[model samples]
Target: MSDETNNEGLNEAPWRATILTLYPDMFPGPLGTSLAGRALENGLWSLDILHIRDFAEGKHRNVDDTPAGGGAGMVLRPDVVGRAIDAATGEGDMRPRILLSPRGKSLTQEKVRSLKEAGGAILLCGRFEGVDQRVIDGRNLEEISIGDYILSGGELGAMVLMDAVVRLLPGVMGKVASGEDESFESGLLEYPHYTRPTIWEGHEIPEILASGHHGKIAQWRHEQAVALTKERRPDLYEAWEAEE
Candidate 1:
């Protein structure tokens, strides 16, 4: 619950988030503008980019150490990362901790919506090799990945997840309808949309779409969404069909 009540005496506060990363500057730029920026400016969501290097013990200020068993790259030390998370979360039991790792659960729009209801989470962006397993185990962090591929670091994935989650925060989106109408919102692909001209290069838009018969148009959209999903992503189509 939030303190700022509206004319209806309702206080719908935004989600509160804190990010623990070695590269703090990597986060504040794009994250500081657009929708996420507006959310921060409005206090709909709060983000603290706690630098893991700040907790480093000594000179060189190294947050990562060479792999113990003769591996390729240096892994992030648990001590530095653990300490940073502790500082931001204040040793509480309720704080949500997330490790952005490729081995974790696949991220989905439904999952994004669910995480929004959770009041945000702490995103741990792993660099170099990866964060020490001990930190993840000790903190009981949930690991989530955007897809099946690997990237240089978790920073991009963390940002993607944050953007998805934060936009759902109250007041973050200019129009709620916009988010609701996006792909995967209805467990199906978004209906085809066209702007202006209606006919470009002689590829005229579908006549049924422009017919304005609301019921027929809605049905056509549903069929298109289902058909598109089946053609493009049969896996999603399979899951959607199983439910029905």
Candidate 2:
């Protein structure tokens, strides 16, 4: 639990996130701005950062070493990372422990929702080559990948994951519908939106949107969402169709 004062005064516990990373300063980067930041201030959620280097021992304070069986880069030492994990999660903490890696399970909106329901997470950001496999296995860290591409480090992935989960926290967004109607929430890309201008350059807002009939507007939005999904993301469309 965080010591930060809660302005909202909610009786329930705030969602907690403990981040274990070599670069502790990278966190709450974008998370400290916008809706997520406001939520943090209101004590809807909390963030704790643990510097991996803090757990290193010896005069030089080394936290990584050359990979076993000969690899090109250094691997985070199992002993050091294990110690950090232990410190982050005291006895009997049920919150999921996650390791951000390219090889991990692909992250999705469904997974994000599950994490939010779990109330909190312990995130491990790997660097250099990667964390020692022994530590990853022994600690039972659930590996997660944000996308198929490679990143310089896992800090950005952790931020992305947190951003997705935090927005769904109670009172984070102004309206419940705001999060519900987003892309992937219903297995389709969201329909295009238009604003007061009504016309932008040569383009005009669809006439149906201006119509007052609620049923027709809902139907139009669903059709547009389906069409857009089929064109832009056939894979999602296929899965949605299968379930239907």
Task: Name the top lDDT candidate.
Answer: 2
Each prediction's Cα RMSD? 4.0, 3.8
Error of 2 at 150 (Å): 1.0
Report the number of clashing residue pairs per model: 0, 0
Query: In candidate 1, what residue range of length 10 has the lowest lDDT sum?
Result: 1-10
Scored by CA lDDT, what does every candidate get?
0.80, 0.91
The candidate scoring highest on TM-score is 2
- State the lDDT of candidate 2 residue by residue for 60-118, as single tens digits: 98999998899699999999999999999977799999999999999999999999999
Runs with alpha carbons beyond 4 Å of true place in candidate 1 = 1-10, 91-93
Model 1 C-alpha lDDT per residue in residues 1-244, reported as the tens digit of each score = 1222122201566576788887788876676788777667767777878888888898798888898889798999988888888887864536578889998899999889888888778888888878898999997889998999998888888889888887777766666777787788877877788767988998988999789898998899899999999998888889889999
Tell me the lDDT of candidate 1. Answer: 0.80
TM-score of each: 0.91, 0.95
